[model samples]
Target: MSEEKNESTKDTKNKDKSSDSKKPSRRRSVGIVLLGVLLAAILIPLGVFVVAYATYDVPEPEEVTSKQVSSIYASDAETELARIVPPEGNRRQVELEEVPEHVQNAVLAAEDREFWTNIGFSVTGFGRAVVGQLTGDGSAGGGSTITQQYVKNSLVGDDYSYVRKARELVYSVKMTNEWSKEDILAAYLNTVYLGRNAYGIEAASHAYFDKPVSELTVEEGALLAAIIQLPSQLDPWNDPVGAETRWNYVLDGMVEMGELSAEEREGMVFPETRDPAEYSAYTEATGTNGMIKNNVIAELGEVGITEEDMTTRGLQITTTIDTKTQEATLDSVEAELAGLQEDARAAVVSIEPGTGAVRSYFGGDDATGWDYANAGLQTGSTFKIFGLAAALQQGIPLSAMYDSSPVSLPGDIVVNNWDNSDSGYTTIAEALKRSYNTSFIRLQDDLYNTTQDTADMAHALGVARSLPGVPATLTENGGQPYEGIILGQYQSRAIDMSTALATVANGGVWHETHFVERVETSDGEVLYEHEVGEGERRVSELVAANLLSAMEPIAGYSSSALAEGRTSAAKTGTAQLGDTGQNKDAWMIGATPQLSTAVWVGTADNTSAIFNEWGGNMFGSNAPSAIWKSTLDGALEGQEVLEFDSPGQINFGSAPNQLYYDPVPAYTPPAYTTPAEAEPTEEEASEPEPVEEEPAPAPEVVVPEVPTPDEPEGGGIEIAPGLVIPDFLTG
Candidate 1:
C-alpha cells in the first residue's frame, strides 16, 4: 500500500513540470506577435509617405500662373469701362535681387518669422491641421510656412480633404530638401496675388505705389506682406481700417522676430497707394468719358483711401456714372459746340439729387488737357442764385425793391447794365430773373453790413471747394468779398455748380458728391458698398423753394425741359473777358426735382473769347442753354419724369416795384410762348454786331405778379423814370 501512494505522487509532479515547460512556448509566441504589430505600424506609414512623395509631381499652378485681368465698370458692373492691367498683363516677374532687403524681411515677418531657419513646415501647425481634419472642427488649418504655402498654392492644390492636406505636408518636406530657400521664396513671390489686380511682388509694388519693387519703402513692403495672409479681405483700397490693423500686426511680429525695432514699428505709417486706373494700359481713353476715372480717383482720395482700398482690390469697381447719360452728354456738348469757333470748349456735369452721384460728366474733348468740368471758370449771373438765397435767409422777400440803374462804387468804378438799360427800381425777383447786375450788387450790400454775405451763401450752397478764390471768413481759405461775387465775378466749376443746384432740387439737402457706387472682389463678394445717407441740410426748404420759384422762368420750357412732366428752374450767365467786349465764359445751370445739370462754354486755351458760327459773341442763353437742353432732352428721355416738390408759395411781401418810378403794365408773354420764345428770333440768331456793341444785354426779367391792396390793382411791372405806357394796356 505505501509503494502505490509514492508512485501516484511522483506521477503528479512529473505532469506539473511538463505543463510549466509548455507555458514558455506560449509566451514566446505572444512576444513575436507584438513585435510584428509594432513593425507594421511604423513601416506601413513610412512606405505610404514615400510613395506619395515620389508620386506627387508638383506642377506649377495653372490658374495662378496664367495672366488674369481686373476690370472697371460703369454704374452697371456689366458695362466694363476698362480692363485694369499694364501692358504686361498686371504681372511681371522680378529677380529677388531687385527687391529691397527690408521689403523681403517684411514679407517674412508677416508670413513666417522662422522662414530662414525652419525646415519648410511647422510640426505644431501641421499637427493642428491634421487634428482639425480628423475631428471635423475646421480649426486645424492655416498655420503654414512660406514653403508650405507655396507648395499648397502653387504645387499641390488647396483642397479641404485630408488626402490633399497629407499631400501638402509631403510636398513641403520634399521642396525644402530639393529647392533652396531663396528659390522657394522667389517662386512664391512671383505667384502670389496682391490687391489691385496685381500678380507678383513687382506688379504689386507698381500697382500700389506706381514704382518698381526696388523702390518699395519699408512700410510699403510691410503692407504687401500683411495682405498676403488674406489678400482680398485685407485689401488696402477696400477696407483700409482692417488692412491697417493687419499691417500693424505684421510690424509687431517683425519686431518680435528681431527683424524690425519696436520703435520703428510705432513710428511707421501706412504708405500712400496709387490709382489702379492709372496703371492700366487700356485706361488712356481720351474721350470725355475718361473724366469719370479722374473723378473716381479724386472721390476715393477724399475718404482717406490712397487709391483702391475700397475702390479697387483686384476687384470690380462700379462707379456712379451712368453709361447712357455720359454718352448723351458727350453728344450734346459736341452738337452745341459745333459750328462755333475752333477755340471753343464746352463742359457739362449732371448730378442726381439726394444721392450726390455725378451721373453725366464731360470735361472736354481732350481728356488729358485742362479739366473744364472741375477747373473753375468765371461764373456770371449763374451766381445770382447764391445772392438771392442769402437775401432770403435774411428774412428779405423777393419782392424787396432795389435800384437797377447805374451806380458808383467807392473806387469810382461805374457799374452799368450791358445795354445801358435802367429800371429805376425793380424787385429782387425781377433782378435775379433778368440777371440785373446793379440790382444784385446792391442786394448783396443791403443784406449784410459787409459784402461777405454773398460769399458765405455761395459756400453754404456747396460751391466753396470750387470757389476757393472767393474770400470770406466762413471759408478757412481767406479773401475779401467784393460786389463781383454777387454778379458771378468769382470763378466756379461746372461740377460744383451742378452740386449746388442739386442741393436745392433735393429739398435743401447737400449730399457730398461721389463716383464709386460699390466695389466687389472677383468672386462677387462685396468688399465695399456705398450708402446714400441723409445728407447735411445746408439750406431750409423755404429758401430752396423760393429760390427755385425766382429762377423758374430763366430757362424756358419750349426748347428744353426735363422730359415733359418734369418742372425745371435754371439761370443763364456770361462773363466778359475784361473790356474786350467778348464773352470768355458762358454758363447755363438748370435743375429738375431729380437731377441738376450745369453747362459751361468757353475758349479751350482760356485766352480767347467764345464766338458763334457767324462771329457773334456766344452768350449763355444760346450755346450753354442749348447744351443743357439737349443733354436733358436725351438723358431724361426714357427715365421717370418727376415733379418738383413745392414748399408752398414763396412770400409776396408788400414792396413796390420801384421807389420813385410809377408802375407800368406788365409785359404779357405771348399766349403760347415760354421765356425763351418771348425773346425775338433775331436776338437768338446772334447776327454779328460791330466790335463796339455794348456788352451784351442781360436777360429780360419774367416777372411773377403778387396782388397787393395798396391801390396797385393794375397788372404791371416797374417803369423807368420817363418811359410811357403802351396805349393798348393803359387805355
Candidate 2:
C-alpha cells in the first residue's frame, strides 16, 4: 500500500511536471502561430505592392522623349546638306542593325558577360557592388550589368539617390520581364554615344573609318566599343591617344574574356582618316538645276535649313539631282568656260522630261560668293522654241511656205533674216532650221493680232514668268524694236529654261522643277512626296515631235556647225542688248535623250561688243556655238550611243515657197601628172569665165523627191550610221 501510494505521488508529481511543460509549450505554440500569421499578413501585402508598382506603366519622364535635330552623325553622309535622327534618352531605342558583330562582341566582353543568363540585375554582381561601395575600394569596379545600366537610364533621373536606385531596380525587373534581351541591346546601340558627334555605333564607324559598321574590323570594333563608357573622353576621332589607351583596355578585357587571341590583337591596326574634308567645309555644294551652291544655300536658308544645321547637325538630304548627269553637265560647262575669256561667266540647267526632276546644273564661277546662275537673263534665241511651237500649234505643216523677205510692222519696225538676207520665200522647215527671223515674225503677226498673242505663246511655254509686271504700254511685240520678240527678247531663269526644254523632251509636258524629291522626318515620317508633274501635259504630242525634228538638225544631221558628230540637238543665241550693262547674252540649249543642259555666257555689264565678237562678218554663229559644241563634246564622253526618236513621221503637206538646187562642186585635188605634168590651158585655168552675178534667183517652187526621215538627223545630215561615207561626204 505504501509503495503504491509513493508510486501514485510520483505519478502525480510527474503529471504536474508534464502539465507545467504542456502549459509553456501551448503558450509557445500560440506565440509561434501569431507570429506566423503576422509574418504572412506583412509579407503578402508587401509582395503585392511590389508587383503592382513594378507592373505599373509609369509615364516616361519628359527627358525620355525630348529630341531635337542633333549632330547625330559626324561624317558627311549626304553631300548637299546634313541630316538628323532620333535619340535614346531613357531606355535604349531600336537602332539601325548595321553594327558589326565584332563590335557587339567587344562591347559584350567589356560591359557584361553573363548578360544573356541574368534578368535585370546579377545578384553576384550586385552583392559585389554593395561590398565595393561599403569598402570604398572599387575592387568590384561598379559591377553593373548592361540591364541594370539600361534600367537606371530608363526609369530614374541620373541622381545617385537610393530612391533612384530602388526605382531603377523595380523598372529593370519589369523591363526584363516584358522585353527581350535583343531588344534591350538594340536600344543600347542606338542610344549610347560613341563620342565626337557619333551618337551610335554606326555613326562612329563612319566617322572613324569612313565605312559602315558592318564592315568594321576587329581592331576598329574594339576601338569604337571602348568609347561607350566615356564617349567624349575616348572618342577615336577626337582623341586618338586616349582612344588607343581605352582601346587597349578593351583589348585586354577581350583577352581576359577569351574573345580574341593575343596574336589577333597584335595584328590589329588603327584605321587612318581618309578624308578630313568629309568633316570639314571643303566639300563642293554645286547646284542641281544650273543653280550654284551659293544660290542653293541662300534658298535653303530662306526655307529654314540654317548654316549650323548644314555644317554640324549631320542632316541627310537626298536631292533631286542625278549624280551622273550633274557631274557631266558641270564638266561640260567647265570645259566650255575654260575656252571663254576669263572675265566671262556661264551657267547651265537641266531637268528630266516627264519627272521635271533636275538632272544637272552649272551655276558659273561668278557664283563665288552667291549663286548667280539661277538669276534671270534674256531668253535670247532659245526662246524661239516657243515661237516654233506656236507656228506648229496652228496646224502649220513643216512644208508650209513663209515669206522670209523683210517685213515692216505696225510701228514701221522692219525685220529680216539674221543677216538681213531674204530667204526667198522659205518653207517653215527651212526657216526653223535656219532660225530665220522674218519668217517667225510673219507667223507671229498671223497668231497675235494684239499684244496678248505673244503673251499667250509665252504662257504656253512657261516663259510668261519673265513677262511679269509688264504694262500694256509694253508692246507684247517683245521689245522696243518689236523684232526682239522674234529675236528672243524676253528673259528667263535657268530653272524655267530647263523646264521648257523638258517640255520638249517629255513629249510636250512642262513640269515644275523639283529639288527635294522626298523629305523624311527625323522619326521616319515622310513629310512630303513630290510628284507634282505626274499627269500634266503641256503640249500635244504632234507639236513636240515636230519641234524635236526641227531641233534634230541642229544636233544630229546639220547639228550646229559647232556640234557635229555628237548625237545632240542644240540652238545658239547671241542677244545684242541695248547697253553696256546689257551685254550680248550668248545662250545654248542642248540635249540628248539621257540629259539636257542650257549654257549661258555673259558679262554682268552686258555689251553689244560681245555680240560683234561672236557674230563677225558671218552670221550670228560664232562664240555661242563654240561654247555649245565644246560643252556637248566633252559631256558626251563615255556615254552610250543614243539617237533621238521622233514622235512620228514628220509631215509636210504642200510644196515649199521655192525649190532651190545647186550641184555640189566636185573635188579636184591638185592634178598630179608625174614631174612632167602639163599645165592647163589659159581658157581652162580661167575657171569658165566666172558666171555672171545674177544673185542666183530662188529655184522654182515645186515638190521633189525628199529623203525619208530615217536618214538619222545629225552628223551633218545623217547618211547611215554604219554606211561608209563617200569622198564627197569627207569633203
In terms of TM-score, the best-performing candidate is 2
Candidate 1 structure quality by residue, lDDT tens digits, 1-731: 89999999999999999999999999999999999998898899789999988987655432334343445678877876654444434655566788888888889888887887888788777678668767977766656888888877666778767677677778888878777788788778876878666778987887788877998888999999988878878887788898999888888888888878888778888987776566653353556645666566555555454443432235577888788788788888888777787667888989998898888888766544556776656577788788788777766787888998876665334566654568789988887766666777678777654357776666666774322223222222365555556666555678878987998888777877777788666445775678899877776777788888887866762244455756788987776554445566778899987679999887765545677555666567777887898888777887777767664544543222111111221111011111121221322211111222222323442222532111100011101121111100110
In candidate 2, position 287 carries an lDDT of 32
For candidate 2, the 10 contiguous residues with the lowest summed lDDT are 710-719
Supply the TM-score for candidate 2. Answer: 0.62
Cα deviation at 362, candidate 1, in Å, is 0.7
Cα lDDT listed for each candidate: 0.67, 0.53
Off by over 4 Å in 1: 1-70, 86-88, 91-281, 304-312, 466-477, 557-565, 647-731
Name the lDDT value of residue 284 in candidate 1.
Answer: 38
Q: Write the per-residue lDDT of candidate 2 for residues 315-380, one digit (tens) a residue.
A: 345566655555656666566556555555566666666666665555544223223245445555
Model 2, which residues run further than 4 Å from truth? 1-97, 121-171, 236-241, 266-323, 341-344, 354-357, 364-374, 397-439, 448-453, 461-486, 509-537, 555-568, 576-578, 581-584, 592-594, 603-731
Give each model a TM-score: 0.57, 0.62
Provide the lDDT at 645 for model 1.
63
